[model samples]
Target: MAEHKIYTMSVAKVYPHYVTKAEKKGRTKAEVDEIIRWLTGYSQEGLEAQLEEQKDFETFFAEAPRLNPSRSLIKGVICGVRVEDIEEPIMQEIRYLDKLIDELAKGKAMEKILRK
Candidate 1:
């Protein structure tokens, strides 16, 4: 019987910002490629070491920052999430909605509540 060895591959994805930023700074395509290679290699090595040390699958697959300038912002949801960038009124509105939901769930309020 022959023993088999399995190895997991690590993939590093670079954001579009790297290329755009490099071009805007007047770096040639070849230079940009080299930079990308160096960054990806360093990131991969660091991540692999972290994974080995932590031995946690979720931590190993953590999201890395995108290199592109025009990339969309990352977003996530949580049960009691608060965002600092939004206006106070918006936050208050969310709080009110949450309260309304709780009230309805507990059979406390059946009337429609309108927010101005």
Candidate 2:
């Protein structure tokens, strides 16, 4: 059997990278944060607190205040794996965020991006 490694990367470490990628494509960090809020239901303050504390992705999602139910409607292949094909709920949530970031970077409008 293949060995499975643990996930320990902090969201704070990755957040700036996401911001930079989106900014390179003309998207703003606020826009990225907005989509993150939409997915995780973290208030701006709550999200910032998580970043300030250097929370891991596992804890970030596990501790999300509210996960938007509409996020499940997002379906597509990301990184060669179908978003809907992910069997784990937390993994699904993470992929949902990734998909939203991709859409944001692609210039999709906030309303449509939020699936509103």
Candidate 3:
């Protein structure tokens, strides 16, 4: 009897939203996996160090140029105004902007008037 050798794919399952979005964009499962791996590579360690050194998000954004104006990664643009931008700093900006809008809306509610 001969022993059989099998090669299983090493890609891990990511968020369903990612899979769905990737599929909707016409990307294959393999391509999506490769993109994920490439986006989060060994450079994560270096990014962590820099993130620690510059605790402020804006400061970090300023220092990390590659992740600032833009970085054309397999996933998307790493920053700037590009449609594919997926940088954390840009996400944070969006979040804060939403919160500001919510706060402004809360302050503009009309008060009920009492009838005599």
Which structure is stronger by TM-score: 2 or 3?
2
What lDDT score belongs to each candidate, Candidate 1 first? Answer: 0.33, 0.86, 0.33
lDDT of 1 at 1: 33
Order candidates by TM-score, high to low. Answer: 2, 3, 1
Q: Runs in model 1 with CA error above 4 Å?
A: 1-87, 112-116
Q: Give candidate 3 misplaced runs (Cα > 4 Å).
A: 1-14, 42-116
List, residue by residue over 1-116, the lDDT tens digit for candidate 1.
32211112222222234344445655444443333223223264564455356423222233322232211121222246532233343233233333433333333323321111
Candidate 2 lDDT at 13 equals: 86
Q: Could you give candidate 2's per-residue lDDT for residues 1-116 as a string of tens digits?
A: 33222235778888998899899999999999999998999999999999999987778989999998999889888889999998876667778888889988888889999999
Steric overlap count per candidate: 2, 0, 0
Candidate 1 lDDT: 0.33
Worst 10 residues of 2 by lDDT: 1-10
Q: What is the lDDT of residue 72 in candidate 1?
A: 14
lDDT of 3 by residue, 1-116 (tens): 33211111111221234455555655444443333223333144544464345434333334443432212311212123432343354444333322222322333221110000
Q: Name the top TM-score candidate.
A: 2
Q: How many angstroms is residue 92 displaced in model 1 relative to the true structure, after the best TM-score fit?
A: 0.2
Error of 3 at 87 (Å): 8.5
